[model samples]
Structure formats: C-alpha cells, structure tokens
Target: MARRERPARVPPRWVVTGAWRVHRAIYRVSGGRVGLWRPKPGRWGTLRLTTTGRRSGQPRSVLLGYYEDGRNLVTMAMNGWGEGEPAWWLNLLANPEAEVEVRGGTRRVRGRAAEGEERERLWARWREIDTQLDELAALRSTRTAVVVLEPL
Candidate 1:
C-alpha cells in the first residue's frame, strides 16, 4: 500500500460538513470532473457514488475517497470521523446496487461488507495508507463498515 496523508483523528463536525458541501458541489458542477482529481490531505482519489435511498426511493449522490482492490472500489463508512454509519452505507445495505463514477467513467456495481479475513486485510491496507485509522476509529463508538463495490 502506498503511503498517503491522513486526516486528524476526529475532525471538527463543521469542517467535515463544509468540506463535503464543497466537494459535492465541485463534483456536480463539473459533471464528475473536478472533484475526483483533487486528493486532499486526508483523502485519496474521490469517486461519485449514487445510491438509491432506502425510503425516498430517490437517488442520493456523494463524493467519497476510495481505493481500489482488484476490480472492487473500497471506502469506509466513517462519515468524516463522526459517529455511526453514513447514509450512503445504510442505503447500500438496503439495496446493494449502485453506480459510481471514477476518473470520469461510470460503472454499475453491487455493494457488500468485507467480512472476517477479507475485512482484516482491507482494514490493514487502509491503516498502511492512512496513519490516522486507529485514532479515527477511537473517536466513534461503533466499528466502521468497510464497504466494497464490485462491478456488475
């Protein structure tokens, strides 16, 4: 795993919120061009994830930092160092089918939580790239979900 800059153990809620607003806006405004290229200090390459809302049945989109595992796209449900699972992860659990855009290309994918050894391997990979993994996890009570998106 390549070393990468990591975020603070627990980022301020306002910073997290503000960053997301800016990231999402850039992603949408450029039609998945600008946001995916800028790898921020604590983030890797960004991807635009579109998931079907569990209740609203509407499409919900978010910009996330992600890594690649073979053909799968990997990301954490940390919600920017905040507590609980993010809505995108919850939505994926309800309906695993989703679409993601990376480097200006879109693909259909099915989401699943990595389990046992697979989870361990992936988590270790994250730790290697992100020095703040443990500290970030400590900030939250619940374990973060390691989500994998496999192309369909």
Candidate 2:
C-alpha cells in the first residue's frame, strides 16, 4: 500500500485571501442576508462594526467573532492573536466611539479593553470553542478586549 500525504491544518495566506474575498462577496450579494449567521450557544456572531481607521480616521469595516457574556459582547483583539491587535481594535483605541450592526439592528457603542481575571475568564471560553487557538498562540501574542454597546 502507498502512503498518503496530509495537508497543513491551516490554510495558506493566499487561501485566507480567497476566503475573505468570498466573505465580502457574500456580504454584498445577500446585502448581508446570506452572511453573518449566528449559531446558537456561543460567540460566533459576526459583529459589523464601523470605526475610524487608526491612521486615516476614515470609516472602516470590521467583522469579528463575538460571544455574549450577559449584557456585553465579548471578543479579543486576536483570533487567538495571529496578527496582534487587529486594526479594528487599534481604531477603537484611537477613538472609542463606533457603530455596530448585529443580527438585525444597528447601534452606537463604547469600546472597552479587558485584562487580568476578567480577560482570562473570557479567553478561557474562547479557547474552549476553538482549540486551534492554542496552536496559533505559539506563532504570536494575542490581546483581549470587551466592547460595551450602549443602547440608543
């Protein structure tokens, strides 16, 4: 019998490009109708947040994974921190005011950073949902943050 080769667990950089292209395409085609589907019992919701670009201060689109922790939406600046605080988080650091669209409505919110015990707890849950995060941690450092969406 011949031996079979296994592929790398993570997609190549170019494949990430393609996946993002598809994501954008679906966002447009469905007017976000076929996109941003939130699975039950976890923080898999796609938060459509508009923030000023950290450098440009121009409006930017950020679609990040979110978990509901009581009254707040919990997420870290990293996907287990592949690239360190994503641009979106940087933007919030520069300007805390931003707009967020979730499920069916849009609202304005104030961004908050999380650390110590609180951050540790939320991140623990994150790791639980996606075990792949542990492997990625070896490649880079990850920062955690919690954004509070004030009801309008």
Candidate 3:
C-alpha cells in the first residue's frame, strides 16, 4: 500500500508580540469594516483612531473602539489577557493632545481624564466589552479620560 500525505491547514493563526502591533495589523487587514458589538458597551467599531506623535507632533492613526457618552467618545487600552498597556495608549499618556481618523473623516481630539459622574458612566460601558478590563479600569479609571475631538 502507498503512504498517504496529510492535508495542510487552510490558514495559520497569527503569532506576534506587542498588543498595538497586533491591533494595527488587524485594523489594516480589515480596513476597519467589521467588528462584534454588544449592547452592554453600546458599540465596538473598527480601529480608525488617529493620535499625534509624542515627539514629532504629527498625526498617528490606528484602529480602536469608542464607547459613547451622550456626544463624547470613551476609549481605553484593554489588552485581553495581557497586563501592560500599548505604546499608542502610552503616547496618549505622554501627550493627551491627539486626533483620530474614522470612516474617511478625521477629528482632532483632546484627551483628558474622566471624573465622578463621567467616570462612572463610561466605566459602566467599559465593563461590557471585557470583564478583565475592570482591573485596568480601576487602575486607570481616575486617570482615564475621553478624547474630546474639536473642530480643526
């Protein structure tokens, strides 16, 4: 009898390090078209956020989700099963002044920490996506702020 060859797998799972790098690649590949949205958090859309370079003061675009609070955008650096935050989020930490690009449009946003009522409201929404985020939120909740996009 002849030996049979085994079939190969269709597609391989991605093997990469760094949360933001994985995040950026996913955004680019999908073109920010598809995302799984659950009601608890309202919406989890494509990563099309643009932030300013910490040093150059230029624009930096990446994919991310925005939780809503009336007209404001709520976001976080939630890396599932990971402990550290991403570089982009760190960049925002370095310089809260940043921008975001979404659906072919752009917005200039100023990052500031949410306080009291604002934090509670956004935290309620944040809990929806990942429960693990609660730990992160607790650490960042006070310092966590909304990116208030202004007319540019």
| TM-scores for every predicted model | 0.88, 0.79, 0.58
Model 2 ranges off by over 4 Å: 1-9, 79-81, 141-152
lDDT (0 to 1) per candidate: 0.86, 0.69, 0.56
Which window of ten consecutive residues has the lowest lDDT sum in model 3? Answer: 7-16
Candidate that would win on TM-score: 1
Model 3, span 36-92: residue lDDT tens: 232243445543666767787777766666655554556666433234665567677
lDDT for each residue of candidate 1 in 80-126, tens digit (9 for 90 to 100): 87877899999999999999988858999999999999999989888
Q: For candidate 1, list the clashing residue pairs, or say none.
A: none
Clashes of 3: 4
lDDT score at residue 99, model 2, on the 0-100 scale: 85
Q: Write candidate 2's Cα lDDT for 35-145 as tens digits.
A: 675535643677777888979979998676776777676666764244556788889889888887778777787777766787678777777777665565555544345
State candidate 2's TM-score.
0.79
Q: What shift in Å separates residue 120 of candidate 1 from its native position after superposition?
A: 0.6
- Number of the top-ranking candidate, with lDDT as the measure: 1
What candidate 3 gets wrong by more than 4 Å, as runs, is 1-23, 26-43, 56-58, 79-81, 135-152
lDDT of 2: 0.69
Q: In terms of lDDT, which candidate is stronger, 2 or 3?
A: 2
